[model samples]
Target chain A: MLRLPKFEVKNPSTVEEAIAMMHAIDGEARFLAGGTDLNPNMKHRLFTPERVVALGGIEEMFGITQQEDGSMRIGAMATLANVASHAELGLAYPALSQAALLVSGPQLRNMGTLGGNVMLDTRCQWYNQTYFWRSALGFCMKKDGTKCHVIEGGSKCVAAASNDTAPALMTLGAELEFANATGRTRMPIADLWQADGIWNKKVAHTELLVAIHLPKPSADQRGAYGKLRDRGSIDFPLFGIAIRLDLDAQGTIFDAALCAVALQARPWPLKKAAALLCGTKPGEESFTEAVEQVAALAAKQCRPMPNIPGDHEYRHAMVSVYTKRALLAAANGDGPVHHV
Target chain B: MRVFRLQVNGDTVEVAAPEHWTLLEVLRYKIGLTGSKQGCDKGDCGACTVLLDGVPTLACLSLAATVETSAITTIEGLLPAHRANGGEGADPVQDAFDRCGALQCGFCQPGMILSAKALLAKNPNPTSQEIKQSLSGNLCRCTGYTQIYEAVVLAAKGEQV
Candidate 1:
């Protein structure tokens, strides 16, 4: 039986109170969202905070509301199920909806929050193990040991970014709002992550993610997401691709964004591939060329370590295959953006 | 210890719960409602599934203090309601499961039945694909899900299980 270690839980009625409580705690503490990721990690002893500031009681930090200018502001506490099933989000940002829906399953979706998904911990086979399992293996740099198991004698941890919604949100150019005891700040979602696995996110420990701001979708905008995993559900992505495109009046691709996840410490934006799509005519010949170029670029840019399940080489190859599938779906406006 | 007032199975019960106690622990150990099994204890398995405000949620991941305001309905709560809803004396979901031979070890039954009930309540006539998607969170090690799917379909049609 996996029993949670004893810790004090602080429930605050508001975000301001939560931050103040977090600041007041003398020992190490963690913000508790849905407890989907944090609870499991706690059970594994990967995280052993002395105090937990529970955010579920804050009423202001929940729900999805549309702005006057047509954009949407999603509170950090909004459950994945709520975000995925929201009528506006489903129509405006299908990739976001699909990514949220594809995360874990129904029961988890009910408990897991959008904020938690966006800030999900980077994962690796070597690190995401029980305390006994990891302790016996002589813990890696991610936990307690000196060296990285994935990249022998490597200085930095190379855990893959396993967040499913991150790539999709990056493709849509989403922004995040964060608050702390001092003040509040907002930044583009792209700026939230760094390349280092051990300290992957740019957000400070004191800052709490408050909400996600999604810009209104243009009439000509289309987006899609595809993820590669062993199972249809519950498993995190071995590799995932998200593509967002804007077509001009002439139906030519004017702007495009491509992002890949589970390949490295952070989702990599395939700038070269998006550049190739710009001004390209939407046709079989153009798509084929774009696919080839994007695949080649991804294969060169991504260095998939043997951190997760599936053969590294096979997973690397699927990056291109899935990218092409996502681009095609975005262009064609398909329902099932996700592929096995 | 904190005393939380929870509406469980139509009863307003107050229990002294620890700050870290999950709804699953409170239900099984404290409240003695063992119908909701603790399978993985993580959210991966649906064995600890229960209805929180009419929506299926994992009890193992839900904090007892956080969910005090909401009505919690466990598998045991479904029985009388199911009978009242013209289930012919037995709970419709349970009757369907028994009639369809949907259990081998019967460990996954409670969660599966609740998931199916939630689905049927929202979408009475769901397609095969929808049924599969709805129960995708549930893991049945014994049955291959064919019988369970059939049971849900039968229950939706109001047929005797």
Candidate 2:
């Protein structure tokens, strides 16, 4: 049986106290939300922090509130189940709901929080491994050694960013609220990620993601999210696609945002696809071409590691399949209001 | 280390454990509640399924500290009489399982039953596809899912074996 490394567990009722503890412990401390992801990673000896500050005790970070602006402010610690089952979220942001529902499973969604899903560590077949497996392979850049096993002579780590919610949130132009011992700051969701794997999450070690702010969707706007995994349940995505479209009275696509997840340091906005679909009607042919183009572009940008779960070649192929499905779903204007 | 007083199976027990100790470890090792077995340790398998505040959860993955104010129910808490006394001679689910030979070894039955109980509590009537989808995380190598689906359907309708 794998054992969790020894560490001091601290539970703070308030976010301020939690931030202070993080600052006092410095980089030796790590925040624990759902632990659905962090606990397993810790058992693998991926991170041996001296202190684990439990954020699950903070009640203030566990609710959902609607702003007067028709936008919603979701507490970072809100469980994925709460987000997926929320009536307002299901109505306004079907893309976000779809992403939330796709994570792990029903039991995990009940435990995992929105913040943890959004701030999910970048994964690669090579990096998301057990200590024994990594040691046997002479270690990769994201872990102990310098050589990147995914790509020889490559300058960066090729760990896929396996976060499913990032792409959906990015497509909706969401904002993030971050807090630390000093104070808090709000920034666009797109700026919160780095392409680099080792430090894909751009937050300071002390700062906690406080909330996610999603703007209300316009009346004519429609969006959807799709993911490709080896199996339907409990598997992380090989590739994920989220597309949000704003249509004019004539049903011509006016504004389009396309995002990709689990492929880079963070959710990457596909600017080229958005530009291609800007003035187009996104008919059957146009949608197919746009999906094909984005899929091809994603294939070119990613050098999937042989490390994760499925075949790297298959993952590349799924990028096309998922993108095509997401575009078609958006074009057809058929997104489920909620899963259950 | 923190000592929490929790009511498990109608008994109030105080367990002294590390703050990060998961409820599964406490239930199995500290308190000797061995019915909740650990198959996958992670939340992937329902082998360690238990009720936290009446909601089914993976006890192996749930930290003990998180349930300070909530009620916890384990398989041991459900008496055999209770399982048999569902307005019938024997619970339709168990009777169907016995008739259909749903379980060969019975290792996964406790978790599978509890998960089914949780599902039926919320959705008394569910389709065969819904039952399969809900129980996807619970793996049973023996019956190959033929009898489990029948057991769920029979239980939902309160029919005799």
Which candidate leads the pack in lDDT?
1
Query: How would you encode candidate 1's per-residue C-alpha lDDT over A1-340 as one tens digit per residue?
Result: 5777778888899889999988887888889999999888888888888888989889888989999999899999999999889998988888888788888888888889999998888899988888999999999898888778888779988888998889889989899999987788989999999988886899876689999999988778888888888877788888887888888888888898988889889988888878888887667588668767877787787767798878998998777777778788888876445553
Tell me which residue pairs clash in candidate 2: A125-A307, A125-A308, A161-A262
Best by DockQ: 1
| CAPRI accuracy category, model 1 | medium
Off by over 4 Å in 1: B83-88
- Across B7-126, the per-residue lDDT of candidate 1 in tens digits comes to 998899999978788889999999999999899887787998899888888888887877888889999998777666665577877888888988889899999999998999899999
After TM-score superposition, the amount by which residue B12's alpha carbon in candidate 1 deviates from its true location, in angstroms, is 1.5
- Give candidate 1's error at residue A186 in angstroms: 0.7
Regions of model 2 farther than 4 Å from truth: A282-307, A335-340, B80-96
Alpha carbon lDDT of each predicted model: 0.86, 0.77
What local lDDT score does residue A112 receive in model 1, on the 0 to 100 scale?
A: 92
lDDT, candidate 1, at A51: 83
Cα error, candidate 1, residue B66 (Å): 1.4
What is candidate 2's local distance difference test score? 0.77
